[model samples]
Target: MANELMIFAVITALLALIFRFTSLIVNSRRNRKKAVAFFHPYTNDGGGGERVLWCAVKAIQEESPDLDCVVYTGDHDASPQSLMDRALDRFGVKLLYQPKVVHLCKRKWIEETTYPHFTMIGQSLGSVYLSWEALCKFTPLYYFDTSGYAFTYPLARVFGCKVICYTHYPTISLDMLSRVRQRSSSYNNDALIAKSVWLSRCKIIYYTLFSWMYGIVGSCAHLAMVNSSWTKAHIEQLWGIPDRIKRVYPPCDTSGLQALPLERSTETPIIISVAQFRPEKAHTLQLEAFSIAMKRLNGGKPKPKLQFVGSCRNKSDEARLQKLKNKAVELNVDGEVEFHKNLMYRDLVRLLGGAVAGIHSMTDEHFGISVVEFMAAGAIPIAHSSAGPKMDIVLDEDGQQTGFLACTIEEYSDAILRIIGMSETERLTMAAAARKRAKRFSEQRFYDDFRAAIRPIMCLPYRNSNDVISNRDTDEERVCTTLYTVCGAAISNLFEAIHKHCVRAVQRGESSSLSWLGLRRAEYGCFVKFSRLLQLNEFLYKVSKCGKIFCWSFST
Candidate 1:
């Protein structure tokens, strides 16, 4: 009798669990709104990524008006109108209307402080948890992840929503694996792990496992839009979704910035460095290089001001910014250096108009929207000679020299000294070339590529033969050959006038030193699949031409 009672209880518990699971699936499927819900928690990050988010929302609004846009956010103060205003003020993106906001209580779980160790996997799992909360509260027909949280794709799938993600970069890559195997110490790989072989081996194993999981979850996305060729290559290698992955570069505010005069104010020439105060951004290199240049400047040359402008994401970022300020004081060049935190669009435009040159230093930057901005604003760019800037943005345009590229402190300092030495005519000529190249990354290009990439996936209504096929046609929605859905409204400008894009500056080593940038597949260390990038090196091996202060056209 006792055994029979126990069996009956077990059966009842199993039945209850199944019933609950079934009800959840049914409820989520039935209650979903026909809209695209963007999974972006930190809306006020004020980076190029956030700009992409607002632009994506705008693209959806202009193309399709039937579906409502919803943002899944951790920021408690967010409202429909506030987000809309931020889009316009912070990114210069004007939305058709206010987007619906879905706030999440479990945002702390995704915060860096929540997991001291294993932050990558921790934040990723936390994203899944946060996503669960988001889906449970308000399910949508389409789940669009603008923030590269690939881990949440499976959960979004479970909720029966079509998954689409705009991947800025792969969460884990072969470079990380190589870094572990080589015992290289960097932000992600600590010195302790690098020093101990056993720990390094254990970490390699961990990364290997994580990579596998990341690949699996990433492949779950129905459509993947990558921001650059570098990102596209990596995502294809990992997700193995070659057909679905589309390379649509991030949008740049070229039109707005293009209006800024190429002729600068003759006052103290400003050299602008725009980027977030993050470790990977390598802001210290820019400061160090600036000090070196100051020391080398001739007595007759006027002192140029080095302006560091960017946003702070968290306490760590603020601390880093403080450290940079303290470093400037230590270098005794504090008087020559300036720090501008969180400036608005109009103010940033004004600053860009006055700047003679801009700099960027981050390594392996995929595609630099900020680099495009500097070029658009007629500021000479001295960018890192790897990935995007080398392969895309800083290239010579129309057979004219566009900007400089460098890698080390010595190279960057030399570039700065060269810029100062150049005559006004020489500088303006290069700036004009850069401005022309910046047009390639304009917002219109992003809109066209974005719409084309998602057209088949969105499954919009067929266009009639009478419809206009021009790219500039705003009324294409009425007789739309293709359409995408996602949108929001403008509130009182929450960001006020705070919209500045980052353009991290660094220079390349000599030609021999840059040989590694063009490595063969087998020579690419742990990344043997890099054969696709072989042609990138062919673009140019820079040769000193006409003793000019700038490098020649990269892709013209």
Candidate 2:
């Protein structure tokens, strides 16, 4: 009887091992070589972040077939295969996207939960689970790019995979912080209470968390990649990271931007502004600068009509435009300045094809993708002399003295007027110089730089002696990882639903005759402050319920 029992136990143990090994084999079968995954919160509109993500994808695929690219974006319905196909063909890079997950930014439940994944936690539980599943299926080397999502580093590192950050720019700009503080004081009435209450929890928490995360991941990562020298300096300054951050300037498809044979007519000198309408982009400042320049040029010489072409991303930006139009009307330059939002790429290229000068006003914009786009079209770029432009756009010897650097409203006005008065020979010379400089940021160069950044990491050995794990992880971990990921996603969705309903309930009751029953204006103030103990209890319940769902599913 004792012998038989021992025999049964040994057989059971052998079966368990067989099952584990089988799972491992299945996962390893799908794992890819030299693969890195890129995560972006939103995928719909192509922006600077998207530009960086796509460039690396193209480079990795071209340089190393062993490398695979996985992109996580917020465009929920986007067909990953189709998106990847389109991007790869256009950019000369082969790539694929992971099944996208929907993430709403303003939705309280999602913002609080999903935001933390990239910030403090290297990876969100859901992201890890999904990523793990992908690894099991493909076994690609997992390299992460933090340029897209603000948070996800902690969860990423915890998974024990190599990560490469294509850091475009720091999240918190000192200028942005000062503006927020100024606005907070003016609107909140009680300065102390306003600063305490309305100073934006997202900015403070997200920036501090991401800053810390960047330091942590940056110090220990397999590799660090940055877009511009300005960004590298910024990262080093902010994080005090001793290690050198590898520079990979985001590629601009300059092949198309080669000098077109369009004749320069001195009759209608066109001034162009190409940028998405955001407060940061400062379209208002562009309008004001143009108005001031036209005034300065009013020696009865017919001034150029200023054309502002780009899409507006926010309602507040649109409203700001209307106010600027009012200013234009007040200044009597309304007809001379045109605001065109949402231009097709081809149309924009055509517009740049005609324009003589390109204008950008965002202070220290990480890397001005549009600025180079303008130069590529043979338009002389007179960009703000800060951030990425200072380092990337101009030659050190001449740029330091002759480069356009506007610090104030008056300075921008002066720069525009000065550009207008330059002789055709001078303008053409500057335009040629700008175009020549823009060539350095071409797609091919970008790919080469990106390959250089990850070559060392990709060369690392896998457990398999002969074969390297260039792209992803082993099979057994993948199976468990996927199981946990699917479960976590379901939970996140459930929590999001609950949070929406609770916030909605509070809002709907606002019109009720019973002031006490609904959230009074005061109770709706801050999540940190509520009047009665029960109200606090109710708020906590909602936060906890939302947090609980997030924690439970994400923790898996």
Candidate 3:
């Protein structure tokens, strides 16, 4: 009996020590300088996402000049001046000041090759570790995630930072679940997995579980900014924080493109395709459609030259580009198809100036910035007939058709043929309308909307809230969230429901609102704050039900 008491005393002392240590990490929130840290692991990808990062940094610099801007990147060669120059030279976005860089070493963990089987969950969890490396090095007043890494937000909250993320698209969605259930082979679902019923069922279950965890972690963000209408809806449904979600269009470089003339040169009509060479972009589909279009011409009409222009982000992308070149050769349209990789803004503009139309074939693209760019450049877009293009961009402008939307390869080929057959007057008329429609997604509009969304959160106090709504957690507050929340019942998403329960319980005059330091006398024997719940899943559900005691609660 004496030994049992001694063991109990040791356990109590251990919990106290851990609680104090976690509190120090949580309470040490204030930085010497008021700074904003943008968590973007890959900064030199030269994609639309990278453009967004630079534009966002520039916007923040303008909004609050006193706040220092820092970019957490994995690129070893990246410097303040180099990134600034890339922004200007590549995307024509000029930064007011250089952002401080924090180099990350654990980037490999987030790479797709690291976990070939469970890539989605692998990368999601990997991002949490990467964020850990980033935040430990420099604790900022505001933690901004330009890249869509939802899993890292909870850890950032634990470090007492106000988390904000500009989500391009949801990490998981009903569409993914549907695709798996239907056994459809797409970018994420493997053809092999789709063929086997058992495999498909197993994957569906895995996705459902991951979706729940993703929703929980994603809710930790103080503000969630989405890029498109499609993106907004998915994030709203998935994260279950519709109140905090804001729909902001991505910054399209329309201002510069709008300056180009609508009239294409009398040379061969060029059809340009611009997007990163990722699997989902469907570069092969564009190539196949172009090949069919070329065959259909057969000396009857002038065959338009197809131009493939984009950047390769990694080895997989580089390999994909090479495979595309090989595919062009195999398709016998090698001579007709031209590949121009990583072209500068001026070069791309020059190509856009000569192009009669642009082709995009990615299905369910959240927001097609490239499609908008195509329209802004006076190129009638032939885009996929779903998501961003169909819902937002490729609609009637001033009572006239602005662009074409296609689903199948045959439909895309037909659109190409129609564009080639159009008279100069007809082409110019449509191009003019498309450009007018494109003006809505301009860089200035993004800056205005983005500034408005972040302003309220930037001014919020670093005070504790049971939900991941406000800002910093107090000394014991973070320990409860990180240790207990992770281990106990109020894991981010759990906090909001638990808080609401406690608030209702208190209003009923049943129980007092609780905190990490608060415990009901006699009924609760030990200082069992959430950071110490062993049977967290079971206990948390009871806590959510407002069962007598031990639930962490907040007034607001």
Candidate 4:
């Protein structure tokens, strides 16, 4: 029965391949324009990622009038005109050429709900499916993933498209592995690890194996552009591909912020935080830190107020904002805390200019564009002690700390107190130093770096209809193509099963332990087959550790 099922799978896969090839041929013949496709599912999110997308598209459009740009987005409700208007109003990025939008409906597969057990691996696989959907809808000469979905690189290569990626952060890192290993008492500690030593070891093994897979996917990209030094280091280390990753600091609109005068009254010092309402941004931490800081400054007349200004991308973000408001009230600082959603660019600049300091609480942030913006606006920055803020932005470059770095709420509170207590001259000096450091990540510099990174890839010979069709004439080529298609489809089907099981589990309000174990076994079986077919012995050896980990998790 198993052999018959295998044969049936192969037959159906071949038929699907034939249909896909025929469609590709037809699309290629009909759509003759050589274009670069930007694969960013949330292009209208009004976040830093969206800014990067629009800026990248604008840079490509400016480089050549002949080269067209296409954006693959999951914002199905928004029209291209609305996106353009939002981009201009929010980021001040004007598009010279209107980008053709390819709306993808299957983006939810990559969401958190689809992968309850193994989020990284599940989301990575889901991204491959989403990329496949985009590729089928509109084939582009160069495929650029601006949303940090490195798993799409191999699929892009299979389709004969040059791959470029602007990675904001690595999907898997040594830090993630370390976190799994560390059984800390903090709220952030892994529950499985905290429960049992055996489970902790199993999770470590799982993370180690997933890191290997993540590296393989990342290495497939032709050019990997990272947004910060921290990101560059992680990508280079994980991908094991040195010299290929370039640091392209994200564009921060500093000119407008810099235009505002640095002199501001500190009678009622205002601390501001500018970041989207994402979980990783640590909005809760920001609120807690602000509350702590307020308590420390009780004796000071007219205590400093905290303002949270950021964009909300979806209903979840709105919910997060409401929760934050409740948290502020719980801390008894609700009256002093102000929430501003989707503030206009000019208004944000005005607030930044008036604020005494900017606070960012997210640890290991990829690159705090908001922190840089704060510095450019002459707002003293108080950011977390790791990642971009510590390593790149708030450095003691000129023998002086440009901004403060804190790790705990007490530390953040102390930093705020220091800023509040500083004299006018001392405050201005630090603010000037921060402003000087921020110039390194200006929009002009980003344009130059981005253009330089993409120019060579854009110059590469594009695979035309004839090239794609002729390349598959050989038997080996055809076999490999078929196998790739079959492997991708198998993986997608496995993910679909897992997704459905997770949905059913959620509806039933129970753990889908049996379904999860079955799916994990099937996934391992598929991985073994794929590795053997591709003759990736080393890769298989590394990935097999995950099977052992799965067994341990199942046993537990």
For every candidate in turn, the CA RMSD to the true structure comes to 23.3, 15.3, 11.1, 12.1
- Candidate 1 lDDT: 0.79
Model 4, range 491-528, lDDT digits (tens) per residue?
55654455455446445644334343344545544644
Question: Regarding lDDT, does 2 or 3 come out ahead?
Answer: 3
Clashing pairs in 3: 484-530, 484-531
TM-score to native of every candidate shown: 0.80, 0.64, 0.82, 0.81
What's the C-alpha lDDT at position 49 in model 1? 89
Which segments of candidate 3 are over 4 A away from where they belong?
Answer: 1-24, 27-33, 462-556
- Provide the clashing-pair count of each candidate structure: 25, 37, 2, 0
Writing each residue's lDDT as its tens digit, candidate 1 over 1-556 gives: 2232244336435544644554564467557688889999998888998999999998988777888999998889999999999888877899999999999899998888899888889999999999989999998888999999999988777666778999998889888899999998887889999999999999999999999999999998989999888888889999998998999989999999999888886457789988888888888999999999999989988888999989998898999999999999999999999999988877788888888889999888878777889999999999999878888788878799899999999999999888888888999999989999999899999999999987777884422212211222444332222221110011102111111000011112122322435633234333223323423222111111110101111000
Off by over 4 Å in 2: 1-34, 81-140, 146-150, 173-214, 217-220, 240-244, 312-334, 396-403, 463-556
RMSD of 4: 12.1
Total backbone clashes of model 4?
0
Off by over 4 Å in 1: 1-22, 460-556
**Tens digit per residue, CA lDDT, model 2, 1-556:** 2232244336435544644544453335334355566655445344566666666665666666655566654445556665665455433344533322323222222232355334224343344444444334444356475543323443344333555677777654454445445545422123553466344555455556655655554554556677787877877766565364788788886877675643466577788887766556877777777877776786755578788776543455567667767877887888887877665455666777888778888877788887887777777677787888876774532452223667567887887777677787787777776777778888778877778777777776643312222322545434544554565455445444544544565567632422434445445545213212323233333333232222322232
Between candidates 1 and 3, which one is better according to TM-score?
3
Error in Å for residue 386 of model 4:
0.7
User: How far off is residue 317 in model 1, in Å?
Assistant: 1.5
